[model samples]
Target: MSINARLFYVYRIVSRMYFHLSVLFVYFFTLDLPVWKIELLLGVYAIVLLLTSKLNAAMLTRMPHKQVIALGELIKAGGLAALIANEHLGILLVGQILSGLGYSLAQGTDSSLLRTIMPDMQAYKKAESGSSSYTFASFLLSGIIGSIIFNYSHEYAFWCSIGANAIAITAVLLIREPAHTNTQQEARGAKPTETSAQKFWKLYYSITRAFAMATFVGFLPYYFFTQTQVSLNIFGLILSLFTLLGFISARFIVRAGNVYGFAKIAATSALLCTASMALLGSSSYLPFGIVALAVLGLASGGVRPLTLSNLNMGEWTPTQRTALLSSMEQSFGLWNAILLIAGGFAIDSIGFQWLMLILAVVYVVLMTVGYWLYHIHTAQPTAAAEQIQ
Candidate 1:
């Protein structure tokens, strides 16, 4: 691995550690607050994230990527500081807003920077997968460590998160942007045959895949505990297993995309996710549910790297790539906010099983239609060019 790739992996590890350190403490810290207030905090955070994504997209043309990443990390550390104080609901809301801004600013740029620095697309894909695996590993380790720390003091956990963020910021600062990046980007400009419609579909697929995974992550535990009657201890073990499988899949399965093609791998992943979700909804058997969860985990982990590989295949300019990726992040935040509001109402109205089944069918229809549209749009241009020739 190159120095940049190593530094990137280090950044991923510590940044993810920062993220997951307080994951289990969100509800715990807000226990005294009303449910409505907690929801308000989440709403504030999501809105801030969406708005900041737009801002980040606009700023990409003017700011250096490393500077943006470092500034975002600094801001995140400040946000963690506020949470560490934890005096009032108002303070917590401020913390969430700061964290959201920081997260949105930094989220898409790191991958963009990695792509810019690496001349070889294959190396970039490998590094991307490796970084993702590191992230998942960090998630597992940080969760365990955070839980242990939280058992003693919440403040200590938040402080440790800030320390991790600081380390990530340092890593970002150490990364040297290649001087030939722009030349390489220009040399590999989008193919003449590519169209805006094709680009849109590629991005759309990624956004949809991310939204589906987010929904599952948000709701699966509830469905398992309430509907399937899984005990807490067993559920925790299952979740750990899921995370482990995700790490392994990200590390190894993504390489298969090079052999079988990313599009095929992505489609297969989507199908697997749909099947797993449907199976979970249709069955009450504990073993079946566990198997479904495991499949979902593997699919979810590999799908992200595949989608990212697809998105970058166009060889867009750094600015264009960053803007599009930021837009995707914005879409994710919007969809997630919508899911948080609607998914609860859906479960209340129709129950978790029905909701899952409906979502499965809906996703299938969407994917089919998206593929058809992509085919029509791409085929028309090729046919026109051929006739002109």
Candidate 2:
């Protein structure tokens, strides 16, 4: 099979149900475990994710991404098995930590693998692929399936998730290791002038992309927690709005990707997220908050995959794909974790509106940096148009 085909199978299984069980398990066992404990776990989970992302990315660069990812999947399955047996809070935490690590390893690496398998630049060449629409559909599907499994048996969902990881593991084993080839750099036919300003711009864009994702996903828990006290049904409705917008937007991510280009799409998404947060923060009305959330959810769906794809296509040493990926993973995971923890506290103390406003400002600054990344990159090539194309 083509590498893409093999990896697609891997994606189908691992992506499909891994999230399903992670969330289902959390709701069933961990949701009511008290806010403080949950916050502590989130903190730990962030640290664990950073460690794993760093290790996996390093391994993939030095050796092979496929092997690293496969090992992660195997470990995940084993962890799940342990969770099934122990059924203790400690056990569940351990299981989640392991699984989170596994997820961190796979998330960005999987998309990079897909890029390796594509038919060059014409065939959706990026660190990631697909669209916002794709994410929405996948998320909606996972939630629907996961909910059904939970309704019947949460334990069954856990087992089923493990089974899915097994399938991913099996597929990972069969796939060829994607080699690092810095064609995008070479294609530019010129090296970036090592100037402070140029370096700053590159860093700026990456930070912005990361910040956008952090704000969207991180602050969400705060929003949800705030609503929990008022009415559970209202909270559920808001979540449903996020899911609905996310799924509907997924239908358009591919088109947006093609039309605006990935980086532009990501920037637009950042702006959308910022606007959503700002709007939500401004409104006391439940309907206003819900509307803002849905729009923000759609943009969040777009930005995460899009910007990560840009990072994947950067000019890292081909021999150091793993290390580069690891760095990316660490940046994303650590910040994401920090954001969640901080946002949780912000919700408990100040309230969601203020948290959103604060985050929205941050998002604007980050996205502005992202907007300039393209210009800075364009400075790299003598034959800029020919190469970037």
Candidate 3:
């Protein structure tokens, strides 16, 4: 990996560590709070994250990627520092919001920076894969360490997270900003390889995927606890298994994308996810539930790369590219906000089985969208072939 790539990898690890630890800190501290309140706080975090992405997009149009990223990291570290200093609920909420803002600002900018350093599709794939690996590792380790530290003292967790955020900020500082490109000039010269319709579908896919994941992360544990006989240890292990599968699959994204193409692979992933939901809804058997969750993880892993590759396809200026991708992320954030809050209530009232069934229906709809994407992908090449002949 290049120096830029290596630095970005370090940044991802620390970023994930900071996020996981911060959230865990808030969570363990707020054990006395109502479930709805906990969910609401998370919803607030998602909303802030989404809103900040829009603000970040506008800022990116005017500023360099490195500056935006560095500022984001520093600001996030400040939030962690606040958490370390205060135990107030209000202060914790503010810290979470700031953490969300930090992610919003840095999210698209890192990818944008990487694209500038190495514009090839392969480089982009490698960056995404490396990011996925580091993120999974960070999440796994943070969960373990955060638990240990929280047991020792919640303040210790916050202090450790602050240190991680500081290190991430330093990594961002080490990365030099890539040369500035004139967005307007590039936009004027860009060819039209993708239609507005394709762009809409890509964003839609992102939104629905986010909704599904929010439902899983926010509600699945409750589902397991209330509806199944799975022990807490088993639940944690199963969740880890999913993360592991996702990590492994994400690493092979580029090769898989090349062999099957983005849309077909995405469609297949959606189909598998649909099946996973169906299995979850229909069976309470431990083995079946494990299979369902595993399938869900595999599909999630597959579609991530597919959707990323699809979003990066088409000719656009860097500003346009980053803005559109950022918009997609914000859309995900919006969906997460909505789903986490509403799904909590729904699961509480309607029961976990029915909730999974509803998600199954949503995935069914997504499967249709995936098929449509596949059709468009196939038709584009055929239309090109005819023109060449």
Give the runs in model 3 whose Cα sits over 4 Å from its true position.
18-30, 80-89, 181-201, 224-236, 284-287, 313-315, 366-389
Number of the predicted model whose TM-score against the real structure is largest: 3
Q: 2 or 3: which has the higher lDDT?
A: 3
| lDDT of the candidates, in the order given | 0.67, 0.57, 0.66
Instruction: For each candidate in turn, give its C-alpha RMSD to the true structure in angstroms.
Output: 4.8, 5.6, 4.3
Candidate 2 lDDT, 306-359, residue by residue in tens: 444344354443324444545556665676677667776666678777877887
**TM-score against native, each model:** 0.81, 0.74, 0.82
Q: Candidate 1 or 3, higher TM-score?
A: 3
lDDT of 1: 0.67
Worst 10 residues of 2 by lDDT: 192-201
Q: How many angstroms is residue 193 displaced in model 1 relative to the true structure, after the best TM-score fit?
A: 10
* Model 1 segments more than 4 A misplaced: 18-44, 87-90, 179-205, 224-236, 283-289, 312-315, 379-389
Candidate 3, 231-325: lDDT as tens digits = 44455556665566666666675567678665456556667777887888786677887888778777776445555655545346666667766
